[model samples]
Target chain A: MSGASDRVPLPYLREAAVALRDTQQRRNLATATTTIRAKRAAVTAEMPDWEALRVAGAAIKAHTLANLGHYLERLEERVMAAGGHVHWARGAREANDLVRGLVRGTGAREVIKVKSMTTDEIGLNRALAEDGVRAIETDLAELIVQLAGEAPSHILVPAIHKNRAEIRTLFLRAFGIAPSDLSDDPAELAGAARRYLRERFLATGVAVSGANFAVAETGSVCVVESEGNGRMCTTLPHTLISVMGIEKVLPRWRDLEVFLQLLPRSSTAERMNPYTSFWTGVHDGDGPRAFHLVLLDNGRSRTLSDDVGRETLRCIRCSACLNVCPVYERVGGHAYGSVYPGPIGAILNPQLRDVERDEALPYASTLCGACFEVCPVAIDIPRILVELRHRTVERKRERSPLPYGSAEDAAMVGAAKVFARWSRYEAAQRLGRLGQGPFVRDGAIRSLPGPLAGWSAVRDLRALPRQTFREWWRARGAGGGATPGEHEGEARDG
Target chain B: MAESARNAVLAAIERATHQVRDADPAAAHDALTRGYRQRGGASLPECLERLEERLEDYGVRVTRTTADGLPAAVAAWVAERGVQRWVVPPGVPEVWLSSVRGVEAIADDAGPRELDGADAVVTSCAVAVAETGSIVLDAGPGQGRRAATLVPDVHLCVVPASLVVELVPEAVAGLADAVTGGRPLTWISGPSATSDIELVRVAGVHGPRTLAVLLVEDA
Candidate 1:
């Protein structure tokens, strides 16, 4: 993560522009998101208590995060008592080092992995590879994304952008799968992945994963999945290492009753996912013999300090918002340039990284409020996006005092002065109309000077006409807006 | 290095608490109004019927049987499927497999690799949630270990009618002992499945290709 975060990101608008050119990927995203949105709406609409469950889910996360220090300590104590080793890491590099060291301790040159955004965020595979240890992705979509040497494009379905034929080709090339063994059928592609990873699951000595929820009351770690790859990783391995962001902790065991209902229904739109595994440390005659829980911070504490941004931690990683987001449905996840993507990514990636980098991510959304409406934990994504935008502007203004602020800041100041009095506003309007002659072309202003230039760079602005609305009103004279004949004409024209 | 990291994280959390908290953590947690239903449902027979419906909806074949007919049902399934090797975990009623013939019954506790070689596994459960059609396994009774039911291509789970609960919360409330006692739990809803490929559901992944359930009246 440090490695990825260190590099300057291409602005989100530019990245999204490039992604928009890929019509095939856009089609894949649109179909996938639309399908998931319909499925989620149907399942949620059937539940009478869906809203109440969302409130409860939100409340549990709120309470846990409020007393996160207390719960984190409790979780650590309980895990140790249950015969699991607990390690703490303050950053992504530290986390990777801890996991890599654990794998080294097991003396295993190769390890299997469950699909974990936290691992991807930390760049654990790359870190492990540098140390001569290979981390093999076991989830079918993750395996596909890994084999393609690309970042995952979606949270739940990592290879959501890849079509069946693309997946078949990857499988055929990567696994040396025979055409008879693999086809464009999703079932056959899944079978090919299963057959390929079956041997690796049994042979691997160490496995690393991320926790869906870690119960602090009883020291249990839970993983929710459909493919048994999670089971293979957490169960078959001799040593199990789970890297959990500090925010995943649930205060009590019963809290799972709320989340278990909320998450599956929200994600993949299922009554219940096929498999949900919960292990409290190591158990005799079952699962991994050695259980290691690595509690990761990685800028989470900084995120927690922000009153508005802390709600980002309440996300259960459902990715429901992604399915319903208009921007995400079109531009896809890669445009966000972070492990987390879509609405959640826009807000989360900036908070989890440096303040200066990824400045435009907060502006990636259209703020249609679909994400906030579908969010199970009630994370007001729009409200947070607005807050991040303001914070971004403030940060820029603070860093560079250009008399008033940045170009945006100066523009706002100029507009404030223009609107203070009607006479100045009218005069300025006339001045603007006169000044726009050279720039206005094709019935739109494609470029502008100094303070107003950024807007014209990506989008065309409608040229200001010769007369203002006030002028039109003045011209109306005694012809009031309330008069039916005039009103009819105005309405028809509008 | 680990020790300092722990201390540093703890210190950071302490600082962050003042910025985010408006009330005490325990008090805020206790003050939460759990408006959703905690438990309570229809009659046991009605719950069992609903359980059967949900299990079938997920492609798990559920057989209705009396206590005495459970073993014959297992045998019939084994014969029909032509299962070659089966792992019967410890605590599974020995009489449940008494009628089965021609198949190698693996009774000893088998490791993952050994279970992977087996064609199927027949096991019991701790509880079954009728609402979600999930058979809960806590490595108790007939349920041997987590991997025994997972590694094999087929999983045959036995859910006694009386064990079926009406809701997920009820099933959760009943698992406090398993949680506190350091026992691992697997809530199997159906055969292993994945919807990751273009969001299309394709069943039969690494867990089990097929899942069948025997719903006995009393066992």
Candidate 2:
């Protein structure tokens, strides 16, 4: 994959950051994330050893990633030996072209697709349309997104942003379903979607999917889903194409045991998904006659090269981190302005692309560390964010030539000199206490003008206290016992 | 054209494999398996218990029986489900379903028309896994194709105890020969369901809503 430099420049993140401050976005996120968070917690709590399973799941992925090239080769060999074809795609363009070529080879005008985030990330539907191969999304939420001509907002529940009433309205308007007959009830909405997709599933000759995990040992690609639509798309079609990210590989089928437990709890918050379909290759007189597995790198190799940021590749797309993210709850997935959204998205998107362009994403988090706590794979998100920030700053410094002797630069040089001395730091703190009288109001700095304004926009900053700790310590007399008045005052002030 | 496409794909893989070998010839094929076993995740027995726990947790009952008793046990289970007709994979051991009085047994190879009329489908698994309680079916003579196990309202998969593997690697090893040979394989974990909106759990959205696995032990 070409770097983000080849796409849009970095300023888009700044624009998204501005949009994220909206109260409507925050409310939507808060309501949705809270609901998902509670449900996930309740379901995960059912497993007594969920934490242990999470550790195992993370270790398996780390081991697999370290030996990715090997497992991928094994997977490809097994897939090819099974009469299945495996295609390698370095980026979205190659993947899209490969899929288009396959569809054209089959002479299929339209193909039914199960929901796959990799496809969404690569804009597969649009690419297929350009190639005159209409891609119909059969997943209920995906159908809504496709019908609305919108991008998916969530990994599992793509149309989570749309409420039942809105979905009913969209269905009626888009599919010509009578609004008079439609009810706001979810079951009715689902029934409507089922009816609409049933014909597509039966008629489509080609089906495309994204695998949850690909076991290299057996060359099996597994797709777990609640709706049977994946089953229809996978089994009924004459030709089946599965697009998967390179990171989805697990070295063995047994590794699925840990993930199967972790993913259901993390994504749908289920004990087990209703349908976990695993296909090796083509079956005779049953399922798809032809099977294609598209192994996509699409910027993953770049992600793997970064020692600090490589952990982002461990994500299973379960969105457990997203559900627990305070920032994600506020901004929702769209505000990230990338196919990947939420806590993982914030760190991952900037790193996948040059962070110099997407600087706004690194600052998106409050550094609450909730994401790190909830990550099943234990990706150190906060650490990655800080590392990305350092990278961004370093890149900026390298881009701008430092003036040989500019006054501003010289002042910074002087300040660095002064800061090297402890006496200077102590004097500066004392000066700040005396100088704060002009700005301090009601024990809070209510407003800050200029670059510091961004910090004070949503929060009130506490004014500096009357006495510095050093001053109080000195006033107490070097080694004397603390007086009750002094102790009480310090406690009350704190 | 098919032959050419096949060769091209094979050539690409061979080239990639050669490159990997040149880069790291000592990379262990069994490294992942060893890692998984040592640090892969849960223990074999624990994984099996968890799988059974998950299956039962999802409202599916698990029954253990010997191969000789499988037919009677499955017959009784089918009777209990009130299913009048059942579809059996072409390779299903005939004795397993022979004793079911008055229940019509349809071959898995029966056209979609015949399968559509069946109440439940019964099949023997290529391998049964303890990790996921998953029944692996390759389109071998007895196992039937993917459609036979999926289309029916209820699916009764008989997994020989001896075939049950401790982990996914063990399962993969068992199926490696068939998989590498291009045999069509289907792995079933549980009944199908979808919850589109509001997190309402719905079952049997596309495939069988009810999945029954008869774990048969060798006598």
Candidate 3:
């Protein structure tokens, strides 16, 4: 998706360290995400059944994914019946090739694009460039990022990292508009883009898009957006190709009711976005005359295999999780080093890629639960992150060179021995208490030696208590008649 | 090769979700607990009033008129904007433009060139949602094509009382026909907006900047 590699090159800590130094990105992310967070809270609170809607959204996605193959077949049949063609893509290469061939078949050198993350995930634009076909991003943010030669920092607002002045400067250079002719006003910059792309929208014969949701019941593809760019790309082109991730398909038309309400409120924090387009197949005289839907598997089936992490597929890409994530706020999206960034990215990136390549992503969250709280589909992202972390460690241990594995594995093995029995654990605790004299300061162990030193460096590990929990429990109120409040008081005192 | 890819993908999905692959997808879907509200509690009058309020909240200039006064309202909007060469798609009432003298009314088939050159496009909506203040065009009758409403500088939409639905669910229930019928639809919540710049709400973009709605109440 980044065009150079399928996997993030460096670990998350390395990427995050670089991103943390960019104060502009951090500030912009904080402000944008905070604003959206408040707005989403407001709009969602107004609905009495907001939680129920979330439940329904989760259920719908789970059901669809459970029968993903069945729904996909139905979608293909319905799309073909409605005068559209459906193609299957096993991976990024296949999906990109399909889109490239479709655009080439139109005999067009340049194609217009709606802001599609799935297309970005497959690197379709670059793939098309190999054949000398140009794909122009029509979304305002996307166009800005394209001109600046950058990746989209935010899923919803791709140019969230760019401010008005940067945009104005970029447009002035790219469109060759004189300095006096353009202003840093967001509206003025948008107007400049409109003027620049209006002709392109009308003239471009091929358009590429990503589906927000594809209804299997009616074979309709839904795209929800604020600007009319999505409308332009889907409507004005003679031939439209929509690349959809397998999980995007929903079981029925009525399911849209849940998503339409959930997405806008959770995505941009509005009751509804400015524009949403739904088209099925090819209309005779309106919109696209020819339509192609490429169903891209692209490791999605692999993601579905993990029962704990499968809820990651339920994500609608609303960016609610990103906006609410504290880690995402400070480090911004770039640190995740993938098209997806934030808590959802933390879990999704690893699951959708080779786990070893993205092992660091799963550990990139504070587990504050804000992302899970705001997730429109109830993705349980925190739970998924924990599960992925476990897998990452397990995978790493399996691939270690030593038969006995690494030091971390040795420590875990030793801990398992001691923890397996209460007597050994008690003996170890007594040994830890005896050895803590040098490290304990102000009742907290601020530092430790060797491998434990790294874990204690960033956090305070409490000194081994003078008495253990079992000892305390035996000493305080041995009778079974003790009330919970009494026990809380005694525990606090102890 | 394509069929093989399709078969492989299907097999992979079946293998991944083997727990539910053999179960009836329809049954699994139907068995889902749809706890969300199906019907909005608003009455018809409330729906109309809310629709006007919400549409106006989106910066759309809204006006109300009876079915009889709709043409006069349209004439007022046209005169107010000084719109010339308006593209009136098929199924728009001829009387709406009969009162407005100066503007040249173009037909539905005016090429993209003509549509881009036109000052405005006016059409009646297929349905309107009260909760979100959104108007849906199903490329039906007066709605013409998606380009008519999109390419023009200004879009004036007519929302009839009977066509208003109170919530998103209610609107989708009726629009399923259009989806299966292969009528591509556009739901315009307001004139174009972009939150891409620092996620700040900025109005007026590539789509029509000036959007006005005429809500006609039944007499």
Candidate 4:
């Protein structure tokens, strides 16, 4: 199993963020996120009981997570009773090896895959490739990313960063088609993908998937998808192996109703996705005769230990948080340097890995509260980010100072000392007012010198007033004359 | 190895439970039952109407007929599409396909490759949700193996009026036996479609592009 520490270091994430400030990437992210946001608003507004449903969704998840060990035990028993084999993997490497072994047992060297973030998280394809097995991604977006030799940038739409023209060029280049003959139309690209993948689907004897929801009572695994690729992979293959994070288990089948409604609207902004396939273990010659379920714990147990951090497990991977996140919109997913991106990634990666390795992730957010509002499970993402930030600071404080302890840390300590007493605070403010003369122009500081330069480079800061509020109040004689309540109001305004 | 991994993770979970305190199982179950509505306030006929309209909205051709007219409707459905070969799963009644002309109904014992060779597939649905315009196939008598409906390029599903319900909950309730019986269920809303490219809705991808649902009403 691989830990979150497998991620690129903090400096890599910072460098990626700096490099991805290109206007083209910004335009792509802006257009895609804005479109999804509008669509989500329209569909969610159609439901009169949307709020009630969200509350129910959160309750069900909380109840499930509180007793995950119990539910997972029940789920294992049920799946085995239904004639399916269950495997427990404590880490990503073990999960990948287990799946590869299953495919090898079937004597097949190739397997078709459904669009699963779990598979990506485990790096299953790369692992399989090392063992001389071919793992073909059948989802159109996934296929596009695979052909372009690029990582998926978005959760729902992996190729969200790529436009139609780039896809057209990629298809033609990868599939040996003449560029002059291929069109950039989406339909044409979809047709080309269908033609390319249909043969692989029919020929492959093994299929791998990730479950959207696994019901413990009925031993059923549900996969929600818009494209038909999932159906082909789940139905036609002789062997099926599904790798799921243990967090995806629900207690009963009836609980599916809450998630079915919440997932479609929140993810794709649709009343229902085009297809949702559910299969228990194996039916008599109906679907795959051999079924395997891998329950992965890789770092989840550690995450569950933190009361405040455990809520991250309730996430359904709907990508609703990603679409509404302003920081994600600007920096894009690649900058996060984790399979899980956006607000959920901000807290999740740091917990899954250690806070020190993914330290920069917590600061990637602006705490705008858009992600929290859009989350179907009502994860207070801003609160979690703040908590993670606190943890990061505490970790920093515990470490001995080396070449640098961070300039911001020194500034914060200095401000804390100044805020301890009123006279010292007022004097510091007066000194700040006088020192702003050189940098201040047209009442705004466009750029700053020395340590503060990085902050002002991207944004403008307004200069301090000539007189402090206390000075103005003393000059007016209003502080001593006004009542306490009225003085409080004036202080609040100031 | 698997047992050791399981033990290690379970030990971790048990340790965490001690730190935060696990809720009682009974209390958690009670809290999970939220007061979500089972059915939208629509009449039976109104629900059925919405199902047809919604399916059609996604480009599925829906035809309504009584049991007596089902045979002819099936014949016309096959003939209009100019299908020369079609396969019917095991449980579909012989009477439904008897009137169909100029088409051969492939045997249920046929392999998936043989099923794929056919132009279309005809099967009866276990349950249909009226509110969502979705059909549930539980591999019941009429619905053969899951691959029967999936392998063919065109699918014509029969949903009896008796089986049509107003909401997802009602449809789920109707399938308690199938659920516990351990049969596979596929809930199809429309023809297999994709919004993968630019989030544009495209009708035909991997599943049957042409889906025509035959709503057989009792005479």
Taking the candidates in order, what DockQ does each have? 0.77, 0.26, 0.76, 0.65
* Better model by DockQ: candidate 3 vs candidate 4: 3
Q: Write the per-residue lDDT of candidate 3 for residues A1-494, one digit (tens) a residue.
A: 22433444467777777788899888888889889889999999999889999999998888888888889999999999999999999999998888877877888999999999998887887798899888899999999988887888889988898888888888999999999998887777888998899889888888999999999988899999988889888888889999999999998988998999999999999999999999989888777889999999999998898676468999899999888888888888777878899998898888887746578888888888999899999988888888888887788778888788766888889999999999999999889878887887766788789978756754677666676667667666576454456644543343
Docking class of 1: medium
- Position A200, candidate 4: lDDT: 83
Please provide, for model 2 over A336-448, each residue's C-alpha lDDT reduced to its tens digit, 9 standing for 90 to 100: 77778777887878766654556667777889898888787788899988887767666655665665443334556878987999798778777866866666676777667
lDDT at A390 for candidate 2? 69
lDDT of 1 at A19: 90
i-RMSD per candidate, Å: 1.3, 5.3, 1.2, 1.6
Off by over 4 Å in 3: A1-8, A402-404, A412-494
lDDT of 1 by residue, A1-494 (tens): 22333454477887888899999999999999888888899889977888999999998998888789999999999999999999999999999999988888889999999999999888898899888998899988888888787888899988999998888888889887677866699998888888889999888889999999999888999999998899889899889999999999999998999999999989989999999999988987677889999999999988898676579989999999999999898899988988899999999988989656588899989999999999999999999999999889889988876877787777788899999998899898789778888887765788888866777776777777555566667766766444445544542333
lDDT (10s digit) by residue, model 1, range B27-120: 7777897998787558988898989999998999999998899889988999998999988887988788888888887753676678888999
Best by DockQ: 1
Q: Taking the tens digit of each residue's C-alpha lDDT, what string does model 4 give over B6-57?
A: 8888888877666554567646676565666777788768877989998997
Model 4 bad stretches (over 4 Å): A1-16, A400-409, A416-494, B19-27
Distance from true location, Cα of B149 in model 2, Å: 2.2
What clash pairs does model 4 have? A1-A91, A1-A92, A1-A93, A2-A92, B91-B141, B91-B142
TM value for model 1: 0.93
Q: Model 4 in CAPRI terms: which quality?
A: medium
Give the Cα lDDT of each candidate.
Answer: 0.87, 0.72, 0.86, 0.83
